[model samples]
Target: MFKNNNTCLAVFTGIIGVVFFSAKAVMVKLAYQYDVSPVNLLMFRMLFALPFYIVILFITRKKSEEHGLGVKDFIWLLFFGFIGYYLASYFDFLGLQYIKASIERVILFIYPTIVVILSAVFLKRKVGPVQILAIAITYVGVLVAFWDEFRIEGSEFLTGAGLIFLSALTYASYLTGSDFLIPKFGVLRFTSYAMIIACISVVTHCSLSEEASLSGYHANVYWLGLAMAFLSTVIPSFMVSYSIKEIGASNFSVLGSLGPVSTIILASIFLDEKFTILQMGGTIIVIFGVVVISLQKRRKHT
Candidate 1:
């Protein structure tokens, strides 16, 4: 019963996170007005987020069992952190520089499908036939949603698409890697370590790239940076790991599809980006796919 409660809570958090993270493209735009490089931008964002997530873990330490993270755990932790948070966010921000937030979000939404495929291939999990069809439907939706720019066109568009694809792959790998530790370390403990490690990795990357230095940015940009860190990075990171722990990856991915939809809605509001007919149709198809995925899981459990 307690587990079930956590599951519900985690899912709710993930949903809220979906909404929170959708503003990232906008945040990146606001930050760019200060002439900040993507790397420097990410450095400030992650650096600020580090303390916030750390404080939360410190306050709730009692809920988790502290374990010795020896060489093996740290090795895995560092790898996952690098790939999951550091690489994913870095590429995402860089990609956003060349693409509209609305387009970037729709592209990033492909990660859910990637997660499903990776789980089936690497985890050797059995997905129902209906689930397969649902995924196909979702893919169709994704293509339809992006038909405007998926064409063979400008190098900038191609680059944005490539970088976003990398973000999705790394993010998918991060999801898979988390599953490796959650069973042994418990969700919260593993999460606490993973985040701290990723923060370190980002710092290291910044130092090596000479992006560690902060300068030439106005005071106004700091607030936007904080909002990005807190809203997009820290909160969503915690919620995603928590949701993965509670509901399992597939269901989490089920909820994850809402991200692009949420991003679109947020774009509509803050970006004044109007929705196209194809995007609306794509959103409907994606939702239908998620429904099919969930129903398939229920059917299997029964």
Candidate 2:
């Protein structure tokens, strides 16, 4: 009974974490209204969130060193960190400029499919029939939702969709590579270190790019940045990690399917994005496909 209660609590935590993560899109859209450049906004996000990770790194300092990871490992961490958080985040923020938050979430949720394909291609892993079926279902849903946006939102929609797709691809690559290191460094330690590396990358890019200055935004922009750093990034990162520890990754992934649905509702409430039948239907299909993939993955592990 205690274990059951713990699982329930973890499930609840996972759901809340996913919802907070989804809110990132709405917040990004809000910040854009103040004419804040995407890179600058991303800089603000990392800047605000950096301290928390720093603290985590400090807390895990002993364990981090105990791993005995070599310079090569650190280099790989830097590479994946740059690819995952820095580049992926930049692309996501840039893409948000051209797409509605709802459509963007749906597009981003396809990262698992990307991961599957990447594993098959790069790792020489076989793509089973079940995986192929899940991938097919996922893309069909993506097309349904994307085509709906493309038809209504006109030509610019393609640009946004493409950027978001790039974001998903890079993030999937990060996951694929990180699989090798997580067991060595531990989740919290690895996450904190990688995020710090990503923070450095974002700051450097912003310093060199057109969005160098991070000043002159409205009070609300700074406030929203703080909110995103805590609510969306820092808090949910830890929460989801805890949830996965308690309930397992497979179950945690099931909760992830709610991400787009929550984003759709939040976008409607906050960003005034339209909530359409097509979007709901597409989201449902995507969830079904992702859940199947998640289950298949669990079966493999067992």
Candidate 3:
């Protein structure tokens, strides 16, 4: 009974996390209304998000020490932080400039399939027929939705889609590469460390880039940045981490299928982005493919 109760709680937590995470793009879209550059906006997010991660890191210091981390590991953490959070997030923010929030969410959701491909390439994981078929299904769905967006949004859609795809690719690389690091440092500690690295990276980049000034934004832009930082980044980060700890990563990942669906709804309600039949079909197909991969992972673990 207790186990079942914990699972139920984890499910609730995971769902909320997914919703808040999905809300990020909407918040970004809203912020863009003020003509803020992606780097400038992202700088605000990482800045607001920085303190919470610092607290987490301090709290987890003892646990982090238990793992005998070295200079080599820190270097890798820097790399992971740069590629995973910094680059991926910057690309995602830039992509949002040109694409609808709904389309960006769907494209980002394809990270699981990218993870499978990355694993097969780098980890020498065997790709069974089931995995291949799922990959095919996933990309076909992406293409269908992407083609529809292209028809309407024209040439700029390709640029946005390409940027979002790169965001997914880099994030997938992080997940694939960080498999060992998570176990060693623990999820929260490792995440905080990586996030700190990413925050520093963003700040430094902003300082160097003349176009990425942090001044002269409307108050709403700052408010939305705070919303993205807390609602989307810090709070959900901890919630999703707890959910994963309780219910396991595979289960947590399966629950992530709700992310794009929630994003679609949120985009429509908040951003006035239209919800079309093709988009719905594509989302369903993509979720189906991701579910297949997640289920396969569960089976392998069990």
lDDT of 3: 0.79
Candidate 3 residue pairs that clash = none
Model 3 TM-score, 2 decimals: 0.83
Q: Per-residue alpha-carbon lDDT of model 1 for 258-286, expressed as tens digits?
A: 66777777777777767778888888987
- Report, for every candidate in turn, its global Cα lDDT versus the true structure: 0.75, 0.78, 0.79
lDDT assessment of candidate 1: 0.75
Question: Each model's number of backbone clashes?
Answer: 0, 0, 0
Error of 2 at 107 (Å): 2.8
TM per candidate comes to 0.87, 0.83, 0.83
lDDT of 2 by residue, 119-207 (tens): 66766666678767776776676566556665676678889999999998897777666656666677788778778988999998987
